[model samples]
Target chain A: MTVGLVIVSHSAAIAGGVVELAGQMASEVTIVAAGGTDDDGIGTSFTRVGAAFESADSGDGVIVLCDLGSAVLTAETAWDFLADDARSRVRIVDAPLVEGAVTAAVAANIGGDLDAVEHAAETAWIRAEESVNSGASEAEPVVPTAIDVVTASTVLVNPSGLHARPAAEFVKLAAKFRAAVTVNGTDAKSLLRIMSLGLSVGTSVHLTAEGEDAAEAIPALVALIDSGFGE
Target chain B: MALGTDWALDWLSRTAATIAVQRSHLNTLDREIGDGDHGENLDRGFTAVLTELASFDDDAVPSDVLKRTAMKLISTVGGASGPLLGTAYLKGAAAIVDLPELDGAALVAMLTAARDGVVLRGKAMVGDATMIDAWTPAVDAAARALAEGQSEAEILDAAATAAEEGALATEPIVARKGRASYLGERAIGHRDPGAQSSALLLREAANAAIA
Candidate 1:
């Protein structure tokens, strides 16, 4: 089926970036941007969704990628409005907004099914998470740690480096403790920070965790990174 | 007198059926400016709700029945309407908490609460050309009917008309929420899919209330 890709996010710039990135990976897949506004004031809405479906030659399913809960829900409502044939060909994947959109587009370009696209999107999220976590180790802490000393490390992995999913996972793990953790490469609070790290496989970096659980947190994070961010 | 559980059950069934009947038409409108899945989505959501309703006892209270329906929609429906409509039922049930029968004022309160919940969740308003387009009008109509002390049937009829009009009114406006907003000026001529389906939902509820 012609897999149609829809990216929904709070920012059109981010969605556009994802589409551009995905296009670089896979050229043949149909990718559309929904939600948010460009400087031109273009916003993704039900009208755009209908137009995308109407214009697509491939009856392949449309995979929706949303940035947040509401976007996902809006997409779901839009999806619900489709005809039987159209609905069957529609799939909504809860992927990280920008990175997930790019990954999903690339997967779709490779003629990936819904499952494959979903996996790619998830994978992208993980990669992004690791990158963010590593960056956080470089800067001041956002999540308070239990250890007294902080160490730093780099991610050395083949292929593309830390991205969304990994960064999210890393941050999630860090949030579990009382330590203040921060990612330095970009705005630590931004989800896009990890995606911007652009870490390659096998690259080395520093690791630091300080607080009561800093010792425990450091090793656990190291283990996660060592496992290729569980990719 | 306590409203029989059958009343709620019958209402749920009728609403499902009504939504099913209008699903295709909604899809057609959505196809003009949306993903073209409104028909299938609502059909699927209501179908799931129907299945869940079938499993419930006829003796169930209105709140219980509505709550279960809300939960089922939230779980089974994958998109925005699921949460929006799900919240509607959930909030409506909460509004009428422990009430066996919903009087006119109680129904108004429940619908108003449901409308508020939808607004909070979707963050869209009447002019956004969303489901709110229909829901807002329906709520207003329902309230007016209640204020006028009309019979249940008359109030429901008014609400249904208002909803239908609201849905149709979306055709000329550019969408501001969900997927259609991306189209910018291109979205101006099309009716909003969410509003269309929402009209069907309100109409169904009105019919059920009267029946």
Candidate 2:
């Protein structure tokens, strides 16, 4: 069972619109919107939140993203009413709703478990925060180490270049193996890092891996890039 | 007289009436530091609870009415007050579940649970210029009255008086929680609508007991 997502917001439009935006990145993942009140007013509803939690969970787990203070309060109150099993699997993440939901949806679509999906959503703002809060390098070079290394290079062929969807797909694949992977000197498993590269149709990126699964991961990603990520 | 369904129902009905009468005042207070929806949201919730008030049976426990009110407010209130007050009722109901009557000690415990629930949900403290500012003092007063072996009505009277002082105390403090916190120093000098409303409810509780 894949992890599901629930987006809670005071505005119904925001919740539904966020689902539509994030759904593009995670087509198969279940992203439910529990926004606004029962009357479609600009406030969170306990009934709406409780129902969303029930429907979003498919026995795996559900990650909740809330906007504003009351949204969190309503979600937490709903959580308190859930059964023990549901309570254990459900989590309310403290992060920006839109970005967190999109990244979480991508992680869920790629079959990441509960913790992985939560991490993806929670870390959604890390890059931006680091840049704003601290002047960190945009190009985070992969840490070089003395380990078994496998390398390959490929050229992108997609018309849209490595955007959010493709970058998410690439990171999804890279994170599956037990190895450190990097593309064009940045961590390959990082969706934001890979997307920030702004690689276009003509750009060539070198794929490198170091660890136990380095031998298999490098060639597989090269094949994925060579395949143009199916456009 | 035992504190039972009559007391609980009377408290809720009186609270609804008080909220309706003071609606504009609450809105005026909220307009200074918040979005000006405090009165509207609270009035809507209590009205919704009143609509379903007649459905309860005579043998129902105090928690029965309280839990029902909690669910109604949680669904109808709409905003931060929804969860904060909703949790107060929910936890308050749970605290006195299955009890046929609430004495001074039981009343103190119930108030404590309600205050704790608000604190847990809103994450606000006594000096935050939120409802907790009013609730904490009321709870503490009830606790002290119970320790002093006061009667149930006297305990509730003490709570009501302390809550009034607490709400008034919020006038000069800057808000440290909720939307009001965004106003920073501008929030000072305005009474917190939530704390004001909380004091009103505590007074209604005392009135119910006296009746």
Candidate 3:
């Protein structure tokens, strides 16, 4: 079967970027994109998705790959309207929006069936730990050194509070380490604790690291906090 | 015109239009548990398919008509549905390629091929809170009715009813695929938008086929 691939994203830029990358990787498979404008207007996403499906023919089955939840729904709806034959041929594969689209396209170019394309897309969603660990062995080992314990004071100035975007980032970084990481001023285990602390611009936080990477970890964390959590 | 042969093109045209018309309603239903764009997206995809319908002549073969529509939908629609629906058509067309008329057995073959194509594409089963909820039962019902020497209208009716019931049954399912899957328990209590729309399309096809 001659299959086409559609990549939907929250923004046209991301979708277009994926298509461009896919073109470089595989020129044989047909790839199209449907999505909202770069600024925001998510409302227009449905229309774009429809437009994408409206453009295909009966002999071609389009595989849709979407970025987020809404995109998935939009894609599903589009699939629902297909005629029996069209619906039968159409396949929605949940692949990573950007990377998955490119990989799927390449697989399709090589005459890969729907199963192979989907498999390639799913395999792309590797565990974060696996990704980090893959390169961990390549790093030079730093000598265990002692670092001074210093309290860096900083208040979250964001209107939504520190618990919003900033805390999510902190948690992500913490997950990367093997040390016993704790967010001071509340129950560190509670996501709400660090959020409720409401660390404003002048709030003080004591960051401590006590593992092999403590020397490097503490400094990096302190720098991160000093930078206002990259706000 | 022969009973089965003449009706194939009409069936495809009507089914395409039905999907386009009800696409938005499906999107609204999906909005509750899903991203709420199922109707709108399908409408857009089918609209494009409808526009391409003029390319085929009145005398085009049934498989040729289906094949063209499948290709158009796939190339135009840009999401999971595009490929799923596209593959369905391609497989169905392939199944009935040389048949001048689609008898009850031919219909079963076509449905079976379509279902296989979907399974290969989505990797979803009957209870996945996806379109398979409607498709699986509809296919089964269609096959059973056709095997029992039922008329085209009777078979289509049974298939449509089964599809509608299947779609409604998705209300309490936790989605196993797509964005709704991320919601986990939250996805429960909401009907799958894809399944709902699939029911509508099937219902319309039944009505059109009999008319």
Best by lDDT: 2
Judged by TM-score relative to the true structure, which candidate is superior, 1 or 3? 3
In candidate 1 the C-alpha lDDT for residue A229 amounts to 64
- lDDT string for model 1 (A18-55, tens) is 77766654557788766452222322344445555555
Model 3 lDDT tens row, A151-191: 23344444444544465445435434555445553322223
Model 3 chain B: weakest 10-residue lDDT segment is: B1-10
Question: Chain A TM-score of each model, in the order shown?
Answer: 0.52, 0.90, 0.52
- DockQ of candidate 3 is 0.15
- Quality of model 1 by C-alpha lDDT: 0.69
Interface RMSD of each: 9.6, 0.8, 7.3
How many clashing residue pairs appear in each of the predictions shown?
89, 0, 59
The ten-residue window of minimal lDDT in model 3 chain A covers: A185-194
Between candidates 1 and 2, the lDDT winner: 2
On DockQ, the leading prediction is: 2
- Ordering by DockQ: 2, 3, 1
**Candidate that scores best on TM-score:** 2
What's candidate 2's DockQ score? 0.79
Docking class of 3: incorrect
